[model samples]
Target: MSEETKQPVMIFHVSSEKGLNEIKKGKLRGVHFFAETCTQYLSLNSSLLNQSDIKEAAKWICSPPVRDKSDSEALWYGIEGKVLDLVSSDHAPYSFDEKGKFFMGNNPSFKEIPNGMPGLHWRLPIILNKVLRKQCNLDLHDFIRITSTMPAKIYGLYPKKGEIRIGSDADITIWNKDKKVILTDEMVVDGSKYNPYSGFELFCWPDEVLLRGHTIVKNNKIMGKQNIGKFLPTKLSDYI
Candidate 1:
């Protein structure tokens, strides 16, 4: 960071108070940084530790550990205060039957299980439905800032990736703020039926997602096949 004049942003698949404090006191230097707390961090807790088999619960495990309710509450406070800046799915799917054996009979130590759950497809809706429903006093613009603009700016994609104005990439998500959907494995494309978010009722969904003049997601489903992505350089020279 001293060499580049850039403070390292932390992207924890799960939130940790200890880690947060470490960053707050570390070599961060007044350099701006953004933390993207994933869905698992915002939603799950550590009680899964008590499962009959730790391995079975392994799939639900993420790094830095899902702390207790106090940690979650602290994270909530951070978000409300603008200390935390972004939320993402961090979505990696592992099959349930594959994870069932670990938790089925023998509880393993916290380190014994595989980690990650599916939600790349449902994160935005889940946030809009659950958090926004509580009337946290955040306007739709706040939503755009955290989920879209801020991250874009930090990553050098700002004014290019996040905006709806002319000359932007035309990538836009049009939300049906009143739409509803029950989150289920059936709704995901990762081919994993095991979602920590299963049984969640999503009240806000995107009805249209456009990518560079092409529509990609419509009616709650992705319209394109996988691997349609092209590589873009993130080097400063590439943008300059």
Candidate 2:
């Protein structure tokens, strides 16, 4: 990762294409590579930098900062071409007070501030709502491959953990494509009150979520106990 410099301020734009090119040329070493590009980068662009008026928006702010429309195009192409493996939230929640103090002009330096934002809930929806909806030629399998199958395969969580088939755990999410609602703080705040998608309309949401063999979420509310979530053991040998 490279930092933005004020003097020249030129960003080293490394698209997935260039990275793969370097690897193919033997300039970089690694037998295989897996990369995760987040929701904020997928849906947002440089327009967000000018949205400093909205303090909460800055909460999700990241550096190697959001690029222009061109970069968005490159990222979309990367996703479509199967260069990017998984889409995750990189979920983090910070209070307005915590984020507000940095931009107060006291420090006046981008490096001094803490970097992160909240989006545990909205990550999946944004992908489905924005990227998938606009993809004209992408099939359903391609969609599932990027979001679910690839992640499981790369991390060795496949067939046994992520897929839906006989003998596999019945983990699944039934999304209601007809459901439409304008997002607001009143409705969703997993651990924080602000959402970047606040006031944005969503056409779909998960109507049901099954964890393993049990129904945990029904009609967007928890149907089972919260503490039942368990951690899985990691075996590095299986993958390496």
Candidate 3:
């Protein structure tokens, strides 16, 4: 149908190697399909679930549960080859209490556990470290594409939300590559207090943040006025 009408199909939070292979096959057939994967697929794996500690395993109870290392490498290849159009956090904010992931039981079934954990704050740091360390085989350019530019373009936020050209929103982040951060669960907010990516050591992080030309953050400090955000309507991009 996509090939017939030249319409695009977006597959969200993609995590399977077989699925990506099929998407590649469809692309070869002239299908306009874009796939987006999250940090879990690219940086994390299912091995954490093998632990005897259900408390630890519970942190990874996400939909399309994190897969093996081979699958993760495949997803990275997909991003590098442009077979994947975007990367996302899929930041579902389910708490660890009985009101959320633990609602069904003290040790709930995977079926009963809500499929999400807090990782939004760690997504960039984790990937940046791997990319900089030559672990992911992706350059800084690829990192920016998957994390910012491509996502903005594909989701119709380009020019304004993605790039740094004239007339675009002055949204920019200055990185301090020399700065290092030891990951901890305390860094997360707007969700549970646990971070599945805790213990990761990142060699860089945003030192300054600007939104629409306003300085919002500097060196982990909040300096901007609150509630300045606006909703944006989108046109699914034809970039793919």
Candidate 4:
């Protein structure tokens, strides 16, 4: 973007104060910059990277390593204030048992390990955990906006993928907000035995998920088959 021509830009999985500050400057100039942060940045910190176990530390490795608690706090503030427009999983579900954090047969260098962590299974529940704890002044609407609505609109899926409007696809998630549980890797159906959030506590999680009115997941069990979905046309969204 320049003085004359402006375009919408989105920074995915942003987790640093420096990036936020730059976006702050752009916002003052009215630039159409959108930013997204993943749930790990909101909960995890760089302290894990400093541990003695390389294998343990590598589980937390991603493109931009998780920063200090201060940066995480700033990101939470960004989410609470709408400075960060969306939250994503950026889910890289590679088991450390393989090439995820290890080389042929030995523990790999941090640079050698594939970046990104596993959390597509817990993105919603983890953020909802923060909302339940009232840590970031997050509400249910904010959750829906960042995790669901905005991403759909930004990607041109709009009222079709995000909302429950009449005639819209019945893609929905039913949540049991009062449920309490401690996380474990066995619960992950993505076939990734290692999870960075293995010990996380959650107050809410999805009870069921419907795709195009088909109940795909219910009571933590997947009932839908693969390759049953269709492609959606790519169109520029007007709501953005």
Candidate 5:
């Protein structure tokens, strides 16, 4: 598969020094690291399992489980050094009950927990807020590049979707740095009844969002009709 594909193989939840070394090796051979691997490693430490309540610890349980608490700084340095390519949520949402399945048995184990958490809505805000608070070295331009431009280019959406040029699609997110949002279950538009980011207070949020020149979100509320998103087809050449 590697020889035939000739495309970057994306790795997930890389949090160890060994993993970082592997990512560096993979990049030379066309490999990329998913952003969540870096962000979650820095944000949620393995110590949380011991420090917080069971429910809180359960919320942080995802694949490639959060690494040793000591590795956070090194992982952040990896992102800063451009060892990581793009950011993604992996946006998988499982209900609270499904996540609790690990604890249902007499002997609870991390292995029984579901493998994902909801972050579709929180991805942008959390990263941007981090930048705002000076927690990371990223600037606004870097944020846009990692979150939008790079992903579009990677998937062949390029000039059509990533840019704000005259002929490009008007897909846009208007952020208000001054606006604050307290993330809670009620604000989640996804079907999940619980959000892993619930109670997070974000300093910046999207005030409006447009899709193909149509207003889809206004005042942070979804206004577009369901099933309005168009599918995009990408060619392997686009990846190159």
Candidate 6:
């Protein structure tokens, strides 16, 4: 395509070294490296689901279906080397009943299972744990860059939303680096009844979350009023 007609594409849930290389070669505009694509790919293989139990298979049923465990390390390297742009949750929530349909033989084919798993609540802690464990070479600044700064900048909220500076929104998360929590279904704040990260121990937890200078969560408990969120605008110029 000619430069005048070529539209920007944001690749989602990249799952392999080849895919990462394609993004680099094509000079793709945006790439979102999802949590499941990073960690679940290392721990779970799609083929194993065929021999595994229902619950196990259901947990592994997300899009760009988790790749071979070996591909994960290379993807991590892409992140550490700045080849990958950002990390996202792709937080799609389906109730146990919905995800269980495939297991119940509603449709035995793996392709019939819904694509996506909940991760918004778990994204922060998982990345932080990987950093703490030396599983990834990212430091706190890199974490902030990928999770907040870069995203805000890409979506046209920079200077006003992502940074710690004068005139910026007060949105922030206060993390307790020493705290640890074993993820459980009960901990999910969204409508989803199951969490893929259930039973994983995370070394850090958000003690508070602020939105526009208002305390939305304190002591890990939600304090925001319902239906209070406002939309922020974005523009094509936000692209890097």
Tell me, by TM-score, which candidate is best. 4
lDDT for each candidate structure: 0.67, 0.61, 0.83, 0.84, 0.72, 0.71
Q: Report the backbone clash tally of model 4.
A: 0
Model 5: how far residue 40 lies from native, Å: 2.6
Q: Can you rank all candidates by TM-score, best first?
A: 4, 3, 6, 5, 1, 2
Q: lDDT per residue, candidate 2, 148-206, as tens digits? A: 87667666676766689887767888888778868777666465566766777878778
What is the Cα-based lDDT of residue 9 in candidate 6? Answer: 43
Residue 195 of candidate 4: its Cα lDDT?
75
What tens-digit string does per-residue lDDT give for candidate 6 at 1-240? 323456544566778878877766655444332221344553345674675465557766787777775677777777777766678877777766744435445435666667677878877788877887777788888788777887787667888877988899889888888898898989877777788878888888889899988999998688999998787777654455
Deviation (Å) of 73 in candidate 5: 2.8
- What does candidate 5's lDDT look like per residue over 101-142, in tens digits? 344653456677666777787878888998888887878787
Q: What is the lDDT of candidate 6?
A: 0.71
Per-model TM against the reference: 0.79, 0.77, 0.92, 0.94, 0.83, 0.85
lDDT of 3 by residue, 1-240 (tens): 677778777888889899889888988887877889999898889889898877668889888889998999999888888888888888877887788778897876667788887767777777888888888778998988888998787778887777888988888888888788887877765658677788888898889988888999887888989789888877866575
Candidate with the larger TM-score of 1 and 4:
4
lDDT at position 232, candidate 3: 80
lDDT of 2: 0.61
Error in Å for residue 75 of model 1: 1.3
Range of the 10 consecutive residues with the lowest summed lDDT in candidate 1: 231-240
- Steric clashes per prediction: 7, 0, 0, 0, 0, 0
In the predicted model 5, the residue pairs found to clash are none
Better of 3 and 5 by TM-score: 3
Pull out the clashing pairs in model 2: none
